[model samples]
Target: MNPIRDIVILCNNRMAFPAIQTLHSLGRLHTIGLPAENEDVKAFCSVFAAKAGVNLIVMEKLKLNIHLQEIVRINTLKCVFTMTFPWKIPEEIIEKNPNVFYNFHYGLLPEMRGADPVFESIRKQKHESGISVHAIEKEIDKGKIILKKTLPLRTDFTHGMLCTHLSYLASYILPELFTLLHLNDKGVQQDETLAQYYKKPTITDVSIKWEHQNSKSIQALVNACNPWNKGAYTQWNGINIRVLEVSQIQTATEQAKTPGTVLEINENNGLIIQCYDNTLLRINTVYTDEGFMSGHKLLAFGLKNGEQFASI
Candidate 1:
């Protein structure tokens, strides 16, 4: 019964919680690595490692290789897993490791790969979204799969909501991963034909182009931005606004005009705004310099019917 712990995890987001907790509980987590640049993430993981009685290493870009050397030297390890780590591991370092390494992604690989898959999944309105656990390879995210599991991606899930949910999904996948590893299963390769990669989004990527977007697309954009970019970016009378919540109206008012026109407002439905293709969307909530408020409350802030939302 050789019993020295044998796994290390390199993580950036707190969304890695369930997987890390599962590893610790299974008595297999040996060391944890977090980037030193992120103060909050570093602080939280520090406390977690302390309480779990495991080793914690602060990974600085220049010192990362040195730390990894120390990790292999001091620990009896099987594999190192990464969750949302912002950079790549040098191939030389990985080649020298005593065991293999894996990457845990928030999206189904081959089709949805690269940065911010959680947001991209919702923004693209996929039928379903989930997690991927794969062996690390020379090309990032193009790894051999240990497991992939998905959940029904609801139309209403915000980026924040879907992200947290996927973390829980990863929790379930972890146990299955342990079993697969015990059998020494060499995971299957990915098909390059089905692959589509998204680059990390810039500030411009999330802006709402009201004039060109239909109701359903606008609403998807809004939900994808909630509790993240605040909401999809737009403008009201030349002032910037962040829409937090919205709904697609089945039938817009018969009388049509230019898109982005404020058609009406009601206590329950909030604000009715015209979109492209004569489609309509209800603005439920938004964030402004005035603070977060329901769409109807914007009335008191000088909102009026017939006013125009700048085509931003």
Candidate 2:
């Protein structure tokens, strides 16, 4: 029987929890959970770290070189794994110790690379998105592929749901990855021609374009921004409204109501708005200054049937 290799996991996201558990059970795990600026994130990390039996090394920034040096000085680090860690190690170190570092990306590489790929995929209405495990080099997500698993991108999947699914998938596949490493396998290189990168989603990206975007596009935006972002939003009667959940409804009413116009309100169906493509959008949930509420409550909160949602 082959001996288990000593591995270090560097992570900041909650999605790494399952994989962390798997690594801990393997009994050769050392973990570094980075400090988050958000108070909620800090609390979550504290809870998860306690359960995982990990003493997190909380740092303000992800200076990989400094962390690696300290880790090597203290322990015999044989391999490193990363998930949602914001920084990359220098190429010289990777060259000196080839195949020692690996990263799990949330998107199928060569197609979608960089931060917020899952959001980008949903925003673009992609039919499929996947996870990739690859060698970590100097260039971000341009490394050689070790193994990959593709999954369908369901139309109704929220950002949180997709992330949870991918994280669980990562936990399932990690053992196979370790076995491959034990056999000294070098991964396949990625094709640069097919590569595209996406930056993190901003407030502007999450804002709804009710006047210009089709119902399907708007629905996609709403699904893509949840749990991680402020969500696709609009203004209503001078109050900012974040649309947390929405569904597209096919309408046969060829009446050309202007986009953003409130077409109807029903006790069960909620606020129905006419979109740019003349299709109806049924909002299910929304966030206001007070808190989250169901769409039907918006009518009682001053949203009228004839009033329009402000594009800005």
Candidate 3:
């Protein structure tokens, strides 16, 4: 029988909860909870710490050398794992340990390498996205991949939905990953030529460019930003309007309408606007600073036919 390996997990998200529980149940898992700025993450950590038979240590730093030193002094440390950790581990720790430190990334590495890969994938309308298990290196998300599991990227998946799905995927994959690590498997190196890094999307990045993009692209942007950052934003009569949901409408007529022009508003359709390619995009839901409002409510707020949305 393979000997039980002593593993340390460093994470701060609810996504890590299931994996934490599974590891703890195995009776060889040690966890370090980082102080999280997100309330949901903090709550998960609190609940995990409260559970019986779980060895958890709370720390304020991500360098993890001091924490590891203390663990090594008291117990035999086998490997380290990270899930949705905000900070990077120091180079010395990885250099000393070699392939022992692993990180679970939400993106298919060498393609989407940085923060918010799910959102980036959705915005780009990629056909597939997946989880990657990799050996932690000095560089952020540039580690060699140990394993990858792909899932179809659904057209309707919003930022929140995609994140929830990925978290579940991580939980499902953790046990298999632990087994591989215990057997001393070194992962495959990533190709530098195929690597593409994406930064966290800014408010500007999520803003809709109605004149430059087609209806499908605009809808993709709205779906990508929903339930995470404010959905793709625009302005109507000088009031900031966040587009929460949208759908494209195929039109047979070749009537040319200016991009952002309100082409139709009715009881059946709510609000439909023309896009760059003269395609129609129907606004399903919108949000103002006041709160969530449907497209019909927008009409009541003095939105009229032929009025154009303010462009960035």
Clashing residue pairs found in predicted model 2 = none
Tens-place lDDT digits, model 1, residues 163-235? 8899888877877888898798878889999999999877677887777888988888888888868998888
Ranking by lDDT: 1, 2, 3
Q: How far is candidate 2 from the true structure (C-alpha RMSD, Å)?
A: 2.4
**TM-score per candidate, chains pooled:** 0.95, 0.91, 0.92
Residue 278 lDDT in model 1?
93
lDDT of 3 by residue, 11-55 (tens): 876667677777676665765556545677766766766774455
lDDT of 2 by residue, 229-267 (tens): 657879888889999999889874578688898878768
Give the CA lDDT, 0 to 100, for residue 305 in model 1. Answer: 88
> Whole-model Cα lDDT per candidate?
0.85, 0.81, 0.80
Model 2 segments more than 4 A misplaced: 1-5, 36-55, 62-64, 74-76
**Arrange candidates by TM-score, highest first: which order?**
1, 3, 2
The per-residue C-alpha lDDT of model 3 at residue 287 equals: 86
Report the Cα lDDT for residue 92, model 2: 75
